[model samples]
Target: MLVGPRPLTFVAVALAAAIVVNSEAASAQPDAGTSQAAKDAARELATKGIELYHKGRFAEALEQIQQAEERYAAPTHRVYIARCLVGLGRLVEAKAMYERLGSEPRPREMAPAVRDAYGAAATELTALEARIPKVAIAIVGASTGAELSIDGNPRPLPAGPIDVDPGSHVVVVTNGERRAERRFSAVEGAKVEVRLELAEAVQEEEQGSLVPAIVLFSVGGAATVVGAVTGGLSLAKVSELEERCVDGHCPASDQDEADFAEALGTTSTVTFAVAGAAVVTGIVLAVVRPGGSSANTGAAATSAKSIVIDPVVAPGFIGVRGRF
Candidate 1:
C-alpha cells in the first residue's frame, strides 16, 4: 500500500506538467531504433501512469512509467519515477534518484516543464534523505557457503545497517540442503534488526508406495531358499566323497562329484551374500526418502513414479535386475 494517500502529491502534479513537451522532444527515442509510433505509445503510457498516480495507485502508476522510460528517453521521466518510488515506500531508491537528477547538468534552453520536474526532484531529495529506514539483517544457523539475499539481490555476510524504504520486505537465507525466510516492515526514521535462520533440515517425505521394497525382499528371500536347498542336496555328494577318498586317495569318478559339491558351495555363498545385500537395500528404501527420487515424498513428489527390483537365481548363476 502507498503511504499517506497523498504523500507525493506535489511531485504527482509535476508529472502532469512534464509531458507537455512538443512532438520533436517527445519522439526522441531512448535508443536508435525506436519508431515514432513507439514514442507516441510511450507518451500514452506516461499519461496513463500520471493519472494513476493521482488516484493513489502507485504500483500501477510505476508500471506504466517504467514502460514509458523503456521506449523513449526523457529527463522528465526520472521525476515521475522518483515520486512513484516514494509513494511506494521505497524512499531509499527515491532519494538516490532525486540526488542524481539534482546534480545532473542540463542545458539552459531546456523545456520549462522539464526544468520544473527537475526542480521538484531536487526539493524531494531534501525531505527524503533523513526519513529512509535502516535495517540490520542477520543470518543464523546457515550452513557454510550458504547465501543470503533481500528482495532477490545478494548481500555480503555481516552487511551492517542498510538503508531501506519504509514498507514490507522479505529476506531469504539458503544452503543446498536447507532454507529460511523472514518478513519485516519498516517505518521512516526507524532502525530494525531482523534475523533469518536456516536451521530446518530439508528432508524428502516418503512417496510412491512400499510395494517395490516388498517385492525386492521377497525375491531375495526366494533366491536364498533355492541356494540353501541346493547346498543341502550337495551334502549327499560330500558324504559319498568322504567314503571314496579314504587313505587320502580318490578315484576319477569322485572328481566329478567333488566338483559338483564345490559348485554348490560357491552358489550358496554367492546367493546368501546377494540376498543379504538386497534385504538391506530394500530396508533403506523403506526408511529413508531421497530428496529427489527415492520413495518420492513431499509436495512435488508424484505417485506415478516407478521403481522395481528383483533377484534372479538359477542352478549355476545368480543376478539382479531393476529399474529406477
Candidate 2:
C-alpha cells in the first residue's frame, strides 16, 4: 500500500530545509551585493551545522559552521565556532574567540535570537576563564633586537597574561646569534612563568692578517741570502789578511784590508741575526695567525685567539718572542 510521506521522512525533510524566518536571520544585514540565492545557501549550511552539533559530531559541525559564517559574515556564528573549538580540545583558540565576542557591543538593534547568542557567549566565557591556562614570559637582559616565539612562530611578548592550551609548549627568545629556549608543561587553569636569561657579551681583539707574515718571511729570506754572500766575501778577505800579516800582527799594507774585512764581518753578523729573527717570527705567525687568507670568505672565515709575536733581533740576540 502506497502511503503518504512517513512521519520520519517528513521530519528529515524539514531538518534539511533552511529557516529563513528565524529572528537570528535578521542579526547582520546582507552585504551590499549578496544575492538571495547566496543567503539561502548559507542559511542551509548553518542549519545543517546546528543539527550535527546536537548529534555530538563537533569537528564536522565546526567546518560547516565556519563556512556559513564566511558566506554570511555574522558575529553570532562566533558562539558556535567557540563551542566547537572547546569540544576539539583547543582551549586557547576557543578562549580567544569568546573574548572577542565579549568585547563586541551587543547591538541594541539585534534581533532577539542574535542577542541571545551574544548573551550565551558572555556566559560561556565566564566559566571558561576558570578552565583556561595562563602563561607569562619575561626576558632578562634582553637586547633591543630580542624577539619571542611560540612553537616556532613569532609572537609579540605578552604585556600581561596569555592564554595557552594545557600540555607542553616551546617558548623561545632570540636576539641576533644569542638564543634561549624553554620547554615545559602547563596545567589547566594554572599560571606558568618563564624567565629567559641572556649570556654575557665577550670583547675580542681583531685578528692579524697573514699578509704581514708572508711578507716578513720573503724579505727575511732575501736578507739572509745577502748576509750569507757578504759573510763569505768577508771570510775570504780575512784569510788573505792572515796570510799577509804574520803572528796576528797586520803590516801597514794589510792594515787597510784588515779593517775593511773586520767591518764587513760585523755587518754580516748583524744582518744574519736580524734575518734569522725575522724568519722565525714569520714562521711562528704563519703557524698561529689563523685563517686570515682572502680565499676564506663568508662562513669559511675562521676566528682564532691571537697573540702578538715579536722578532727580537739585536747585536747578539736573534729569536721569536710572543705576548698573549
Candidate 3:
C-alpha cells in the first residue's frame, strides 16, 4: 500500500529540525587544538624574550616581545610586550601600548598590574619628552632672498635647524625694503614650526620711509644757496674798501678809509668762512640726493632696504648691519 501524505510531511519536518540542531552543535564546538597551538607559540616567544632580557640583551628582548605581541591577541601578552619595551628605553612605544591596554576593563585580579604599568609608562614618556630639545619660532614672512635675525643681530637666512638654549627670543626677517618680526622659543633639540603671515604693507614701512633723505637734501641745498649769496656780498664789500683806500685822501679821510679797510678785511674773512661752509653743504646735498653718485646712491638704496628700528630697546638702538 502507498504511504499517506500527512505522514510524509511529518517525517520531512523532523529531518529538517535534526539537521538544524546538528549544525548548531558543530559551530559551538571550540577548536581547542588550534587555540592551544597559538598560545604555546606566544608563550615560547615571551619566554625567549625574557631569557634575552636576563642576559642583558635588551634590544633582542624588545624584538622578541614585539614579535610575540604582534602574534598574540591577549591583553596579558600585550602588557608583557610593553614592559619589555620600557626596559629597552623605548618609552614612546611602550606608552602607546600601555595606554591601549589600560583603556579596557581588566579582570579584578589583574587591574592593579595594568594600572601600575600604565602609570610607569606615562611617567617614562614624560621624562623622555622633557629631556629632548625643541624649538618653536614663527616665520612671519620671507622674500626670495630674505635673511633672518635674532635679537637684532644678523643671522644666516634659511636657517638650518637650530639648536638653541631653552627660552624665548626675538626673531626678525629682512628682504629688500621688506621686514618682519616675531617672538620664538626653543627647547633642547625639538623643532617647533610656526607660520606667520607678514603684512606686505608693514614690511615696507619697517624698511623706513624714503622721504627723509629727500627732505635732508632739499633743506641742505637751500641753506647752501643762501650761504653762497651772503658770501658774495661780503667779498664785494672788501673789494670796495680796498678801492677807497687806494684813492688819495687827507689823514682823517685816510683814517676813515683805513677803518673801512679793517672792517672790509673782517668781512672778507667771514665771507671766506661762509663760502667754505656753503661749498661743503652743497657737496653733501649733491652726494645725498637720489641717483646723484654711484657710491652714494648704492649706499642710500641699501640703507633704505635693510633698515629696521627697535623702538622698544632704546632711542638710539638701530640695527643696520645686514648681509646682501
Candidate 4:
C-alpha cells in the first residue's frame, strides 16, 4: 500500500515545538537531590529530535527519541516516537503506539505538555483507524496440506478478518502441485474479501490412441464392401427383370427375382448409410480426440446435437443419407 505524505501546517509545527520547549523547560528546573545532569541530557536529546522532526528528517528524529527514551522514560517521548514512525511510513508500529497510549489513563500529576501529547496521540489514533484496511479470506474445497500466504509471509488460513495497511498485497494459495495467485489493492478503511478454490492435481492420460478409430474404420469398410456387392447384384437382377418385362409388366416367373432384388437394394441402402456414419464418426474422433487438451481436466460434457445417418430409399433411388 502507498501512503501519500500528509501536509504539515504551521500550526502543527508550532504545537510540536511548544511541546518540546515545555518539556525541556520543565525538566531544567529539577527538584532537590534529583540528577540534574541526566535530566538535562534527556532534555537535549528531545530538543534535537524535535528539530529533526521539523526538518522532515524522520529517521534521525526517531533515533534521537529512542536515545532520549534510553536516557529517561517519558510518555511525551513516546508521542514523538510514534509521530516519527508515521513520518517514516512505519504505519503499523505507529498505530500500535497510538493504541497503547490511547488506552492508558491520564496520570493525575500530568503536566500540561504531557496532557497535550496524550491528546495528540488520541487524534493520531483516530486518523490511523481510518487509514488501516482489513482482509478476509475464504477458501473453498481446501485440500489437505493446502497452504496460504500474504506478501510472501505464510499465515494460517484465517477464520476471521486480518488487519493490514492500505496498499497492494499478494495472496497465494497452494495445494500440492497446483497453485493460485492474486494481486489486489486495498483502500483506506476498506474491508476486502478474497475467495479461492483449490484445484485438484491429477495426472493426465495420453491422447490420440487411434484404437477405436481403427476398429470403426475396419468395421465400416467391410460393411461398405458388402453393401456395394449386394447393390451390384441387385442392379444386375433389375436389368434381367427389365428384359423379362413388356409395357411395364413383368411375367410371374420374374416375381421372385424382383422381390429378392428389392430386399437386396433395401439392405444395401441401410448398410451403406450406417457404415458411412461409422466411418465419418471414426475420422472425427481421430482428429478431435475427446478430452485431449492438457488444459482441460474437468469432466466431459455430452450433447444431443450430433451426427446422424439414415437410408435414402425411393423409386429409382437407393443411397445413404447423413445429417449433422
Candidate 5:
C-alpha cells in the first residue's frame, strides 16, 4: 500500500483564528453594553462549534457556526462559518468563502492566519483533485475487528479510500489461526473490493491410522511363510514317494504310497488357501488406513472446504466470531 500526502492543516487553523478575530472585534466596538453582549454570544457559539468539530460532529458544528454568522456580520466570523461548512463536506461554499478571504489584504497581525487558511484550502483542493481510489474489503468468516494486512503491513480496518499506486497488491486477512490471501490490481481513482473466506485447519489424527495397515502386512508375511513351509513339505513328500517307488510303481495299491500322495495333496491345498487369504487380508488393511486414497469403511468423516480465490476491485475479506 502507498501512503498519500498529509492533508493541509491551515484551513482548520484559519478557522480558529477567524473565530478569535470575530470575538475580539465584537469586544472592541463602541458602546460597551451592546459590544459586550455580541462578544459573549459569539464566544459561546464559537466555543461550542469548536468543541463539536473536535468531537467529529461536523454537522452540529455547522449548525452552531451558521447561528453565529446570522447573529453577526464580520469577515472573521464568515471565515469560521466557511470552515465549518468545509468540515461538514460542503466544499463549494467553503471554497467560495476562502476565495473571498484570499482576495482581501489583512493587517500584519492577521496575515499569518490568512496565509494558513489559504494554505489549508489549497491542500484540500489538491487532495480533492487527486481523487484517491478507495477499496472496501468485507470479510465474512471473521469478526469486524479482525486484523488486516497489505503486503505484511498492518492497516486499519474500515480504512479510507486508500490512496494506492496504480498497480498490483497482495492483501492478507487473518484472525487468530485462520488466514486468507489475495492479489489485486488497482487504477487511479478506482475502487477495488475484496472478500475472503478462510479454510478450516485439518487435523492429522483424523486421517486414517497406519497401525491397521502395519498389522495386515505382518499377518500376510506370517501366512506366506507358513504356506512356503507347507509347500516345501508337500514337495518333499512327493519326491520321497517317487524315489522309494522306483519308475512308475508310485503306489496305486500300496497303502504307504497312497497315504503319502494323499498327505502331499492335502498339504498343497491348505498351503494355497492360507496364502490366498493372507494376501487378500493385507490388501484390505492397507485400504483402511488413514491417509489412504481408498474410501474408509470404519467411520464417516468430514473434510475442510477448499478455498476459492477470485480477483475483485474492492477488498474481499470476512471473518466469523466462533471456532469451528
Candidate 6:
C-alpha cells in the first residue's frame, strides 16, 4: 500500500554553509597526529558533499560525506549522511546515524558551531524515529516447533511488531514440513500486519486420500479367507477318501465322492492363486496410496457401478470373483 511519495527535505543554503564551516576538520581535532594535509582534504570533501546534496545527487553526496567522515569524524558529517539516506528511502540506516550522533559525549569546551550541529542531530533523531517503519508478524500454528523469518534472517518464535526499513520484504513461517510465505512493502510511519496459518487438514487434503487403498486391502483379505476355508475343506475330503478306499482304487460308492473331492481340490488350488494375486495387487495400491493418480482414477471410473467381492459356490463350481 503506497501511502504517498516521500519527498526529500531540501537543505537551505544557510544551513549547508553553516555545516561546511563548522565541520572543524583543521582546528578541533584532539589528536596532534592529524596533519594539515588531512584536515584540508576532509574540509574539501565536506564542501563538495554539500554541493552535491543541494543538487539532489544523494548517492554521490553520501559517498563524499562518508569519505569525509573517515578522514576526520564530525557530527556534521553524520547529519548529512542521515539526510542522504532519507532521500534514498533508507529510513532505518538514517535513524541509526542520528542515534549514534545523539549518543556521543559533548565536551564543555566544544565550539558553538559543533554544539549547533549537535542540537540539530537531536531534533532530527526524534523525527527519524517516528518515520522509521514497523512490521508485526504472527504465526497461527503450533506454539512450539514453528520458526519465523524476515527476508532470510531467522527470527524467534512469537516474532513481533519488529522495526524494518521502508521497502519490500518477505516473511516466511515454517513448522516441520509445512511452510507459508508472504510478500509485502512497508511504508514510512506505517505499520504492516502479517499472519500465517498451517493446518493438518490442509496437508491431508493436498497428499490425496487413503480410502481407495483401504478398500483394496479389505477385499484382498476377504478373498484370502475364502481360499483358506476351501483349501481346508478339500484336505478333509482327501482324508475321508483315503480311509474309505484300499490298495490302488476306491470303492464304487466312494468313486463319486472321490470325483467330487478331485473337483474341490482343483477349485481350492485356483481360489488360492486368485487370493494371492488379489493380495499382491492390494499391497501395490497400499504402497502407492491412490486417488491422486490418473490411472487409478480411470480404473475407479470404469469399474462396475455395483460389485461384490466374495467366494461364489454352487453345485459344480467354486471360485472367487470381484472388481476393484
Best by TM-score: 2
TM-score: model 1 vs. ground truth? 0.48
The TM-score obtained by model 4 is: 0.47
Q: Write the per-residue lDDT of candidate 6 for residues 1-324, one digit (tens) a residue.
A: 212112223333333343345444312344445565665676678778867876889999999988977877766677778888888887878878878877766555554446656677777778777888898886777556888888999987654588788889998888877788899899989999987777643322223355665775676677677767777887899898898767967788887877887887777777666656566555555554433423334544334323334545545454445555
The estimated TM-scores of all candidates read: 0.48, 0.57, 0.30, 0.47, 0.45, 0.53
Candidate 6 regions off by >4 Å?
1-32, 142-146, 155-160, 175-177, 199-324
Q: Give me candidate 5's TM-score against the actual structure.
A: 0.45
Each prediction's whole-model lDDT (CA): 0.70, 0.71, 0.49, 0.70, 0.55, 0.67
Better of 4 and 6 by lDDT: 4
Q: How accurate is candidate 3 locally (lDDT)?
A: 0.49
For candidate 6, the per-residue lDDT at 279 reads 61
Candidate 2 lDDT by residue in tens digits, 15-125: 333224333444445445666676677677777776676677889989998988777666556677888788776888887897887776543466544655666777787
lDDT of 5 by residue, 1-324 (tens): 112112325434444455455443322122233354654576567567656766668788778766765555445445555666655555445656656655654444443444454455555545443544456687778875578887687987654445444567788887777788888877656789877776654434444555755664666577667667766776776777677686676555566655765776666555455445545544544554434232342234432112111211112322212111
**Clashing residue pairs, backbone N/CA/C < 3 A, model 6:** none
Provide the lDDT at 247 for model 6.
90
Error of 1 at 176 (Å): 7.5
Which residue pairs in candidate 4 have backbone atoms (N, alpha carbon, C) closer than 3 angstroms, thus clashing?
Answer: 1-167, 1-168
> Per-residue CA lDDT of candidate 4, range 1-324, in tens?
223223335333443443344444322222334355655676678777877887889999899878876666666677778888878766778899878777765545555556666778787778877777888888877778989998998989787987776789999999878777778777777889988777766666445457767876887898899899989989998998999889999899888889999999988877787677668767766765543434343333122123343444455545445554
Estimate, for each residue in 116-217, the C-alpha lDDT of model 3 and write its tens digit: 444454554455445434444456566588777766777675444543435576777766666677777665446766555556543111233345445544
Model 3 ranges with Cα > 4 A deviation: 1-34, 83-89, 108-139, 142-324
Q: Give all candidate RMSDs, comma-separated.
A: 13.2, 9.9, 22.4, 13.0, 18.3, 12.1
Write down the lDDT that model 6 would get.
0.67
Candidate 6 has its poorest 10 consecutive residues by lDDT at 1-10
Off by over 4 Å in 5: 1-131, 176-178, 197-205, 246-268, 290-324
Better of 4 and 5 by TM-score: 4
